[model samples]
Target chain A: GQQVMQIPQYQHVQEGEDFTTYCNSSTTLSNIQWYKQRPGGHPVFLIQLVKSGEVKKQKRLTFQFGEAKKNSSLHITATQTTDVGTYFCVSSHQAGTALIFGKGTTLSVSS
Target chain B: GAGVSQSPSNKVTEKGKDVELRCDPISGHTALYWYRQSLGQGLEFLIYFQGNSAPDKSGLPSDRFSAERTGGSVSTLTIQRTQQEDSAVYLCASSPPANEQYFGPGTRLTVT
Candidate 1:
């Protein structure tokens, strides 16, 4: 079975600080997707990376896929209070079945 | 267009009882998924439906859990003889092939 593991299960930061979360998969992945889940809310898709060694950005957020396609990272610069939530990385293998999600990194930004 | 919608936003049932959760996917979407989220936990995949093909139920925890999609539009997940551990928020999401997914508010189930 394939599994995705995320680092820093929980994080707490003051406003204006930076935050980063990493996701690693046991096997190579065809694609990786990131999502955010607010408190008491459903998970929302953020971005997806399909190519190896790919990078994408959204404002202050940056996402990267490893050259081997076995890991990924999401980094936020100058975090704001609104950034508080859980960040998850999901990956799908060759079979194109359901996405396997990582344990997720819970970010807490304090004002 | 409307996003995924789920029925019985909240359900409280006794142990050993049966419960059914419903999910209505967005129109024209070809893929629908069911997931479970425990308190403060990540999403757990349960089943996936693509078009009219058979569903992928590998993520189901036990034989008591089963799901079906009718006409590729609506889906229902049934749990029989539920136990305390079955309490969780069941989420439904729909997506077009090779596109981002949209999620529903989810149904919170509590087994007492």
Candidate 2:
């Protein structure tokens, strides 16, 4: 079975601090998707990385895909209270199949 | 342009009873998926439907779990003889072709 392992099951940081979450796997991945789920809310699509060693940015957030394509990381700078939520890393082997999700890293920011 | 929608935001059923959860995907989406999430746990794959193709039920935990997609639009998940362990939040997501998925609010099921 394929699995994505995310580090730091939970993290608490100050509002102005930076945070990072990593997702790794023993097997090569075709693509990786990141999602955010607020408390009592559904998962929302954040970004997707497909190419190896690719790096994409969304405002204060940066997503990077490892050269081997088996790992990915999400880094957020100057975290805000709105950043509090669980971040999940997702991957799928083929189209039209179920997405494999990581355990997710819950982020809490205190102002 | 409404997103995915699910019914019965919350449900409480007695042990050994059966329950049905509903999901309505966005118009024209060709793929739909179901997942379960327990408290403080990650999303667990359940089932997937793609257009008119045979659904992938490999993720189903038990025969007690079943799902059907009607007319490539709506879907329903049926759980029979529910047990206390059946308690969790059931989420439905729909995607167009190979794009990102749009998730519904999910249905919380509690079996007593």
Candidate 3:
């Protein structure tokens, strides 16, 4: 069985500060996906990375996949109160299989 | 519908009772998955179904838990003789082959 581990189980930052969360796995992964779950809401797909050493950016957020395919990270620049939520890293061996989810990093931003 | 839909957004049952949760995936999606999340916890994989293939039930926690996908469109998760430990939020997600998943609002089950 593969396990996805995430760091900083909880993060608190002031508005305009930066935040980052890391994800690692014991085994190699075919793809890594990031999701965000707001309080009292379902998890929503954010982005996915497939290639090694891949980096993708969305507005103020950046996602990176490590060269070994066993690690990934999400960094948010100048965080805002709206960025408060749980960010989860998920992975699956294949496209349509069950995904292994990390415990998630819950981010709290104070304005 | 436009997205995955789950029925009975919330459920409350007594210990030793049985409960069935329903998940209606997005139309035309070939894969459906079930996950459980306890309070302040991560998502726990429960089961997976891809098209008409046999479901992957390796994630089921115990014999009392089971699930079925009917006609490859809808799914039902049944928990027989539920215990207090069964209290958690059950989430359903659907995806087209090799695509990102769309999640439903989930069913919050509380066993008293």
Candidate 4:
């Protein structure tokens, strides 16, 4: 079975600070996707990375995929209160199968 | 006409009772998934449905858990003799041709 592990289970940062979360998989993945779940909300798809050594940016957030296709990271710059939530990374091997999700990193942005 | 939708946004049942959760995926989506999220925890995969083919049930935690998709549209997750540990938010998501999934509001189940 494949397993995805995330680092820094929890993080608390002041507004305008930066934050990052790392994810590693036990086996190589075809692609990795990032999701955000707000308090009492469902997980929302954020982005996905497929190619090795790939990088994508969305506004103040940046995502990277490892060259080995077994790791990924999400970094947010100048975090705001709206950024508070749990960030999860999911990977799937066989197409259309259930995605294995990491434990996720909880971010708390304080004013 | 939009994203995924779930029924019974919240449910509270006694121990040993059975409960059913429903999920309605977006129109024309070919893939649907069921996931559970415990309090302060990440999403836990439960099952996946792709078209009329057999569903991938490998993620189910126990025999008491089961799910079915009717006509490749809506899905229902049933828990038999539910225990207190069964309390969690059941989330449903659907994907188009691509891998990016869109999630529903989820059904919050509380077994006491």
Interface RMSD of each: 1.7, 1.5, 1.5, 1.6
Number of colliding residue pairs in each model: 0, 0, 0, 0
Residue lDDT tens for model 4, A1-111: 366999999999999999999999767888999999888787889999999999999999999999999899999999999999999999887666667788899999999
In model 2, which runs have C-alpha deviations exceeding 4 angstroms? none
Query: Candidate 2 on A9-56: residue-level lDDT in tens?
Result: 999999999999999998888789999999989999999899999999
Evaluate all candidate structures by whole-model CA lDDT and list the values in order: 0.92, 0.93, 0.93, 0.91
Candidate 4 lDDT, tens digit per residue, B1-112?
Answer: 6789999999999999999999999999998989999999988888988887788898899999999999889999999999999999999999874488999999999999
Worst 10 residues of 4 chain B by lDDT: B91-100
Q: What are the per-residue Cα lDDT tens digits for candidate 2 across B1-112?
A: 7999999999999999999999999999999999999998889989989888899898899999999999999999999999999999999999886678899999999999
lDDT of 1 by residue, B16-86 (tens): 99999999999999889999999999889899888877787889999999999988899999999999999
Give one digit per residue, the lDDT tens place, for model 1 in A1-111: 366999999999999999999999878988999999999898899999999999999999999999999999999999999999999998888645777778899999888
DockQ, each predicted model: 0.67, 0.74, 0.78, 0.74
List runs of model 4 lying over 4 Å from the truth: none
State in Å the error of residue A55, model 1.
Answer: 0.8
Residue A40, model 4: lDDT of 79
Span of ten consecutive residues with least summed lDDT in model 1 chain A: A92-101
Q: Pick the candidate with the highest DockQ.
A: 3
Q: DockQ for the candidate 4 complex?
A: 0.74
